[model samples]
Target: MTDAPDQIPEPEEGAAADSAEHPESLGDDGEFGGVEEFDADARDAADAVYAALLERVGEGAPRPRLEPTRRAVELLGDPHRSAPVIHLTGTNGKTSTSRMIESLLRASGLRTGLLTSPHLERFTERIRIDGESVRDEVLARNWEEIEPFIAIVDAELEGAGESPLTFFETFTVLAFACFADAPVDVMVLEVGMGGEWDSTNVADGQVAVITPIDLDHQSRLGNDVVEIARTKSGIIKPSASVVSARQQDDVLKVLENAADLTESTLAVEDDAFAVISTTVAVGGQLVSIRGLAGSYHDIALPLFGSHQAQNAAVAVAAVEAFIGSGSVRLADEVVETGLGAVTSPGRLQIVGSGPTVIVDAAHNPHGAGSLVASLGEAFDFDEVVIVLGVLADKDATGIVDVLAGLDARFIVTNPGSDRAADTDRVAGIVATRVGADRVTVIERLDDALDEARDWATEGEKRAVVVTGSVVLVGDAIAIAADRGWNAR
Candidate 1:
């Protein structure tokens, strides 16, 4: 583990773990105890107050709304200025890439702060200070402390005839402020969606990274690959260096143009830095990558899938570029240790044994393609049963087309959220591609996963995947954890 600077000690020292409502001293009499033990009416009021503010994703405000966040910082005295950041945006691999970057930086002995979204189970997974969840008491206190600023942002926005900030936007602002207060050495900020309008882009980053570009978020970004890539390319700022994957000619042109527009230096994969020959194994991958700094061979990643290798190459390049050619070079052992320590939840996460339940938040065509490939090469299941869900916003036909050719019988379900693809609607799409006889649409995620598990018997090797949206994967993980599902 990296050593924390004297300015920012390890979280265990009571610096990062200490929060208002979640201090280490409180036993169990907090807000989440028994409803009868606390003020139910007060809690209900607070929930309602924030519920409306959380309604902004995939609904309204496709363009960047940095003003509200800016107002928030001003009210709080510009906390964002305190944190250094590596902002990441793309169609896929943002979370995995973020984890890799965070871990690599941490390996250099810097106190790392990672903030991600659509957590598998607990909300705390979204914010980690010094490699741990924010102590519950601390988060609760910060929540209360930040509430006034949020409410003020809401009022001013509403008075200006604009909708309130969405859940993700609020989260972006909160994370920036919280990390600034914790004063982490650097933050790995993953764009919640497309980069141009993503709330996380509000922060000024010293480095910008773009992973593989594909067709996703067409409604807000655009229909063409270049348009979408342009949206993601928005994260590139003046004076920042770019580390990106190999992209289509058109998409590559767009990325370069954006880099030029921002006056940021661009490092093209396969040209300046590249990942060479690769081999995938059960626990990790072995690949040789050559970058502007140097070449690394057979570096292993603790995560699954080939896409992760690409993400790792991008991480390795970013670290090298950010630190320049001298003092902060990434030692080969740091690369090994960094990749070994990195893990992203719900991205081919093997959550249990007995029947082998895996969770992946592969809601789009590109992601679905990667998940299908990973299953084929990594596991040897005689039968693969997929428990799937999706958002209404996704192109259901496109998603199904990619997974249909894979060896899996899908038990489809509606994601347990308003954004979920309608169960009947999703089933209709699946039936067209994979046959209705093989597709079953159940409204509940738990029921779908349970049915997939039961069919895994009969003296046959079977693997079950709970996938599609993070909401569905999250629900499946919650059930597995409650029942003590084992991943080994």
Candidate 2:
């Protein structure tokens, strides 16, 4: 492990394990004793840390540079330098690709740490050590140890009239600290947004993975596809192995230029590796992929979409780059088991039955297009009802346009997020794209979902798709589970 500067000490001594004001701690009365008390303590501690981090700037706001994160980690002894990193960034597919890569590495007998962003449910979903979300106690304890150091940095930045570290930056710091404490063999990191100054970029990745780049986050990243690709290309470190998905001509040029400048070896989809075919199966789909070193055939990836197949191909190449320099074939069993074990929580995930409720976190047009295509290819629904909710800053028109041509009814609602676009505004957009008669306006996601289920249950071969934002998908999952609906 890389040493912290001046031997960073442990958490402040004598800090309360369970504070009185904590909601969970309050339940620690006789009503909740023994294991329940222990569990409450864990939850309380984790929430305490989360509440503190949420006080900073929001995750959507990108910091201009990595200085704050760099300094925070530096003061804490640079925990990120402890493990080699596989850094991933792009408009979409980053989380799924990162998860696949982590599974593959773990199957090969390496303890893996995976750090992803915009988690669907719990904040702990953002950091996983050895394939499981870090325990609440561990996450809170790590934060407790680092809180003082973070405050010191915050004071320094405030003295200089600079903003304190944002939510994502602090989470990045905590992830590094947690991963180092776990002493993982390798870590897979997904950038929050554009790559150049992303807090996760503070660590030089040994294998930089770029999934299909698209025009999303145009306000923060540039409008042009090539320009967005250029910003994402920042993760390619000198001599690092670069694995990229198939890209547009201009995007390819930008990536090629970055690889050349960094003297990195580049492997691109359709050229070096690609998903040749995918056939829908019982649970998911069977795919055949041509990887960099060898061809993987008859691989069953339990995820929807040809895009996921593509993501699997990219993940294999990245793992090859990290473990074998893209020259050696992973064992067939290892490849099969690893790919099969992968689970992308909210990407075309089926969270309930009866109505066959499916949820996907497709916030942008490109992702929406992919989701629509996958739905067409994967399911045999006679009629589909879509529960749509989008963030205020998203391309709502583009999303509506993509789904307009589908044989589906639209239920526009909010995802229960402050950033969620108003239901009336979303309905107006949907109405413009696909006549208002086809669009149903609902204020709450749960009510919208109920309406969708009623519509689905009314006929044979009907289904429901909850989408447009990760928050909506999370809500759908919670609602389904609470209602005792079996996630098919």
Candidate 3:
């Protein structure tokens, strides 16, 4: 990896001379910060910045190389080192776990920065500071200052006959810069993909959190669970405190080896930390978690599912690992408050009432099983209609098998992603498992939702669930919001 930049670069020769001649161009900060005379100008500038980022590389395909991100951040004075980092990685529950960790740290009276991936609605949702999405002005301003350094690296890579940085690599640099500019005390970074080569891995975390590694990204990670676990275990740094969720035997062996090599303190779920009990409640669930420090009882997690209960357990342990290196226990009130206020947007998130509509980002069999279990535990629906859209590379058959036992009808559709499996393909899979008569094919998600809503309204205790891909969950969320469905 390239060494961190010694200092922010000086202006170009012409700009320096122009600044000397015209004092107003320099501004007080000397970095393009002046009073915006109108809101429209700021909005237009933000739009331009977002467009420029999208133009460089699309999010769907990312080249897994850290050299470009390393070079880019090196030229920006290595802002990633400004705060202590809590790095998180796993096949499932990474985003939800990251959100929980951020909430816990923020409740501890620290200014926190959070960077997570696959935003449900806006790109701004990826970078959050102090529990809120970063403002458009802040994103635009950071892009203005960081663009020149990125351009330098882009030219160098192209000159060497290599492609420019991918979308996620560049965004990683932006997140680091924004967090450093905010001057946060702690930063919680969730990996965009695998851990070792992910751009966000440039920062050595003080604590590493792994949440239930599974067989989701087999195409990119590996075909087997063991190999995927090995790839994810790379986030655990030497002497770092590691908090991991309960893993299978083969996966656990891989993580143990990684911890041994790194000389890290590893805390496995059901050993060092675990969820004692979870009782379904109104709005969400009440979970009692045995943390690394102490036991937190009856903590209100404003999200559904047993997987979420486990996620809460891991988040508490990660926070405990961060706060006192797993030596000191957090105050009960602090832990209670932090978890009570947590909200995971699309993970078993109910967006509407009256034939309740739920959306979850469960793209694989493991996650799909969790969704089915959670639905059984949390909701008492006599019948259900599921709007399912899966990516082309996913295990459509495995996912359908997991949910086939549920008393539900399937509506297969497109998730607005180029990689989405064809509606007919998914419908065939659903039909093979649950019978052809129980399956419906609606190519568009909006139309699928309309049909599901009609089905849900026909029965006494019926509901609708949208799942299979993050892209579909994002689209469903936007559609629900547009139709005035309040997210709970």
Candidate 4:
């Protein structure tokens, strides 16, 4: 990693010339044309593909191994190696950071492929081609072609007294194949979980971006921050340039050790680069970032929160490292256009109006903390109605503890997943923290949202926040669209 200078420097003449020429358009249609619609036949085919994937082991039960994915991809000609990868792994900001990286890359004239986890609405959302979700026809066709190779791997694993390729493992393979088929110039990959043995680790990332290591997925990743950091640091491959967000001292030590062992250079937030300042703006916030190669002033980021601003800084550095080895400054316009067009769905996203409805996927305590801070910074409300749901494996008590600080009423509900924590249990946790007078138990999500929206309508400066699980946020987004909450 390059050392930061005492003062920011202006770009030398022709510095922007080396940057890739801006494309006529970023996608086949246009920027933000939206996901393509599926015909009945295409929908059925896509549904069949999803059903087949569901038949395998679920994402919750990930096999902490890479050989199976390696074997499958190897048989498919190692599609993961087809493009230079910018890989990201972290607790809270992985998805958002990945989106920022992909957007910046795309704006710089690269045909980008992105893979993110646990989709909010559709399976195709996990794999994006040039800033849009992969089309259903393309997804179905790719699945049809890869099914044979997947079956071969499954039989091989089963023959060796092991389970079949798990959902994430196979999904990782499929995503790689899709990107390779698209022949993307670059791929931004987000790990499904901890990095070391996560199936996505098969690809050597040219730039490994770590976004703020924190405590989450304790049972699977580790029992503490150090253990989790050690697991995530596994993505720092040989001679890779690593860019990381601000982290705890202990976690930084773990990443530093891994980088040293791999002979990789590590650049951390506040050391290599930083968010100089941020001011809340109309739709989002205006940020000034001091990047590894250059300084960007007042870039408009459409996402909310200081965490997102931090994520943007890390992304800028990652792109700097990938494109110019942290030496050449990105074109000022590139930074402006890229950051300006970025969007992170379900992270502080407002899906409705009148009685404003916001949905965030802050399922863990660290994420919950960021959510509360962003809410305080971005929105003003006399009262907040929190429609909360939690997954069974999450730390409900810890999440509720963080949320209890808000001057808000809690409506505990299920997120419509089998993994949803019991409403009574979560409500009990909320009541203990905020008193019974502030708690409401709604067994169904739709009814819960309706009830919350009605209450918000009765008061001024009141909003409904649906959070706790990503699934719940997705459900809320759909419900908001269905009921025309934004129209009202």
Give the TM-scores of the predictions, in the order they appear.
0.86, 0.92, 0.91, 0.93
Give the clashing residue pairs of candidate 4, or none: none
lDDT of 3 by residue, 259-355 (tens): 9999999999999989998877776777888888789887777778889999999999999999998978999877876787676888998877777
- Top candidate (TM-score): 4
lDDT of 4 by residue, 189-235 (tens): 99999999999999999999999888888999999999999999999
> In model 2, which runs have C-alpha deviations exceeding 4 angstroms?
1-38
Question: How much lDDT does candidate 4 score?
Answer: 0.87
| Residue-level lDDT tens digits of model 2 in 49-144 | 999988999977877789999999999999999999999998989999999999899889899889998877777878877667676787898998
Candidate 3: clashing pairs of residues: none
Tens digits of per-residue lDDT for model 1 on 1-488?
11221121112233222121231232355321122234345445444534544555433335456687777877887766676778898888888888888878877778777777656665657777666655444555566678788889889888999877667777767776667767788888888778876777777778888888898878788889988998888889888888888788999999889888888888888887887756765465566777668888877665667777778889888888766632245688877766766767788888777788889999899999999887765666788888878888887788889888775788988788877778888888888887888989777777887888888764478888877888888888778878888664
Ranking according to lDDT, highest score first: 4, 2, 3, 1
Name the candidate, 1 or 2, with the larger lDDT value. Answer: 2
TM-score of 3: 0.91
**Candidate 3 lDDT (Cα, 0 to 1):** 0.84
Poorest lDDT segment (10 consecutive residues) of candidate 3: 15-24
Report the candidate with higher TM-score, 3 versus 4: 4
Runs in model 4 deviating more than 4 A are 1-38
Off by over 4 Å in 1: 1-63, 325-328
* Stretch of 10 with least lDDT, candidate 2: 1-10
The lDDT, on a scale of 0 to 1, for candidate 1 is 0.74
